[model samples]
Target: MKIPFYRPYIGDEEIAEVISAIQSNWLSKGPKTVVFESEFAKSVGSEHGVGLNSCTAGLHLAQLALGIGPGDEVITTPYTFVATANTIIHCGAKPVFVDIDPKTCNIDADLIEQAITPRTKAIIPVHYGGYPCEMDRIQEIAQRYGLAIIEDAAHAVYTKYKDQPIGSIGNITCFSFYATKNLTTGEGGMITTADEELANRIRILSLHGMSRNAWTRYAAKGAWYYEVEQAGFKYNMTDIQAALGIIQLRKLEEMQMLRMQVARAYSEALADCEEIILPHDSHEHRHSWHLYPIRLEEDQLTISRNEMIDQLSEAGIGTSVHFIPVPKHPFYQEKGYRMEEYPETEKVFESVLSLPFFPGMTKEEVYYVADTVQSIISKHRR
Candidate 1:
């Protein structure tokens, strides 16, 4: 049996919502987007939500809304997608990299204070692989430093830090609805915040900095006259994507249960494998299980991670690495970032591989992948 890395669970409900949206004739950012923004915000216990084209846009807008600009530094983990750091560069701000906690693969809050300088304006903590970072301590640090917090929650839409939802904690939280995300709108994202003025600013910044969006400008009771408040980019979510988001939001809990089941099954099946280290789980925080990244104890095996990946592919099992560590990338390297600066991140990247994990994975498929992994390890045991 072949198991792909991920497959989104799109049901008839999503199809129906898309059909209804298309039939309405308003395909751009319209009523569906507005309703999606409201419902998603409410679900996450945030006061406001602004739908955008991608989570990258939300991150960029969050920095812009808080006036993070040239010479400003935003602290974030080197263990995440480059988009997390690229957004800071887009604003002409410097991205200061921090090493991750070896245990959680999230930013090490203990190291944050030492990285902060007078020019530091914000912290963008990423919830890696749906596991939340040490937010309480991060918040305390941010508070003491008077710094804004923009959560890179691309993998954490359903995550919670202690009793607080991920979206409700930070100054502005961004979520992705990409095709492979836990909750998908094909290619969309949302920004959530309790600050009303910040929400309004993000909304304006997402759609060309217009005083009013197309929905309001062309409505029967609206007028054509408007103002461009600031120079902004075109990053509005289309009605078609929001239509999918609306239905996806409704089915989120159900889909999450399936993902949890797959995660549980993997842990149980691989518990006896000495060469594999499972992902961390904590009762204190809810993990969204967006990616089931397992670290291979390479010292216990003769094969390298790349060799294991090749063996898995030959077995018809697909896998992927979570990230290459932002500092190791060519662009970041040219910008003076070095891998040695983030030892933990580089260590994790060498062994980490994301398994096939999605909402609708079959029990047989899960076991087959797990069994194949064990077989590979058995053959290569040192």
Candidate 2:
């Protein structure tokens, strides 16, 4: 009964779709990806969705689209996966770190103002573990500062804050269809936006800044005359990857409904547990529940988070930590971000652990995880 911490829910459909793409002979950024981008945009209520090789690429291009570069600072949270902050650095922009809401592990909107300056060109808010951040307040803050917002929605595919989907509300929202994500395309991402000019710029930027994309340029009836306006990376999504995305996107809401069910079960079973603190939903937002992370009541439990992970592993149940504060990572530390600067992230990082979560897990498997967790916590009661 070995339960892996995360698994991609792929079936024959993914395999068959890839086979169909191979048979179609237009594998590179072809019709399938175009259809996927359009369908994904419609589903998320975004005006445009540009598919890319990875969420990092999407974030980078979003910054490039907004004309953000060196000397510009993007305010963001320190509690996230390093990719969120690293993307800003990749764009040659400085990332201004802010502490998080100890509960949701999202950037504290209250503290964003203190970090803003004339150099703050944008704010990148990470929707940690598919839970929506305080977007209204964050948006208001961005408006007051006249700053653009590039959302790190890597963990959020279906999450909504108030009346808007996370992707639709932000100026530029990036989503990862990574192997362990709610919906996956093996490895790919999307950048959603309402800015048509920005969207057109990103579309070109993703395809090597070509005036005409690969599909249009290589088609039999297409003209050979095309020009590169600027240097850009090859970040276009392949048709094979987009084929999988089409299947996943169509099944997204169904999968999300099940994820919520799993979250509710975990919450109900562990809510009253003495040594665990369950995650909380946002004030006016819906969570996609990508990961069900629990906090160890360190004082009440003799075993540390690492020890608990080891215990879960020994019991044939898998688990992981959502993040280890980005600033604490060696790479960020080398870039001048200190652990002491983000107290809330440091506090959350010390005690958090991500439990196994995916749509494929059976009811019995979920119960085994929950029961094993309770037994381990009880065994190590301090």
Candidate 3:
């Protein structure tokens, strides 16, 4: 009865797609990748999509496409995965940290203006735990400040804010298809934008800045010659990964329903507990429910977060923390990012823990996790 933290919702459909891709012989970025990109963009209400090896790669390319470079600054939340800020660093730009809203654990939109300076070029709002951020307010602030928005949508796929899909809202939106994501491609990502020029630039930069991809160059009606417009990284998504993506995209809605069921079940089971706080979702947004994070009320409990995690592990239940805040890491600390600067993130990081959540989880397993959490907290209650 060992429950892993995450298990991909893969089936025979995914296997068949991969086999079809392998049989096609053109396994690199090819027709399957193109179809996957198109379907994904359409699903998210975006005009264009560029597939990449990972969300980190998409973020990096977005910065590059937007002309963000050294001496520029990008504002983002401190309470997010390191990839959010690391991409800014990769673009040779400075990442300005902002505190989060204690309730949603998202970047506080109200605090964004104070962080904006002459050098500030963009805002990267991470949809923390598949919950949509305050996008409308963030967009208004960006518009007033003349800054671009690059959404860190690693935890957001089907997420929507005020009936608008996340991928279509930001100037550049990035999505991840990691093994743990709501919809997985094992390891893949997509960048979506409305601007045709920017989409083309991202495509070029994702595959060594080449004028043409391997598919086009080797096609019977295509030319063998191509040009290098600029130096770029090797970040193209393969046909095999795209094969998985296509299948996953087709079944996304069904998977999301199951995830919501898990969230609801947890809420129903633990509604009476005053020693723990559940994740929050705004009425205006549709949460993708990627990760179910709970906060232990330290004032009501004698045990720390680590002890709870250890107890869950001993009970054959796996759990994890969403993030440690970018500044808490040693590398960021050396770079002058202090935890004290982000009080909300610092506080949330200490109390938060992610429970086992995935589409593949059964009803009994969901209850097992909820019951286990309740039992552990009861024993530790003050």
Off by over 4 Å in 1: none
TM-scores, one per candidate: 0.99, 0.97, 0.98
> lDDT: which candidate is best?
1
RMSD over all Cα atoms, model 3 = 0.9
Candidate with the larger lDDT of 1 and 3: 1
lDDT (C-alpha) at residue 177 in model 3:
96
> Backbone clashes in each candidate structure, one number apiece?
0, 0, 0
Ranked by TM-score from best down, the candidates are: 1, 3, 2
140-254, model 1: which lDDT tens digit per residue? 9999999999999999989999888999999999999999999999999999999999999988888888885645777778778888988878999999999999999999999
Better of 2 and 3 by lDDT: 3
Candidates 1 and 2 compared by lDDT, better number: 1
The RMSD of every model to the true structure, in order and in angstroms, is: 0.9, 1.3, 0.9
lDDT score, candidate 3: 0.93
lDDT of each residue in 1-382, candidate 2, tens digit only: 3999887787888789989998999888889999999999998899999999999899999999999999999999888888888878888999899999998899999999999999999999999888888888998999988999899999999988876888899899999988899989889999999998999899889888888564577777877788888898899899999999999888888898889888888887787797888888855778899889999989988899998988898898888888988888888888888998888888888899999999877778788889899998888898
Q: Note the Cα lDDT for every prediction shown.
A: 0.94, 0.88, 0.93
Total clashes for model 2: 0
Worst 10 residues of 1 by lDDT: 212-221
Cα lDDT over the full model 1: 0.94
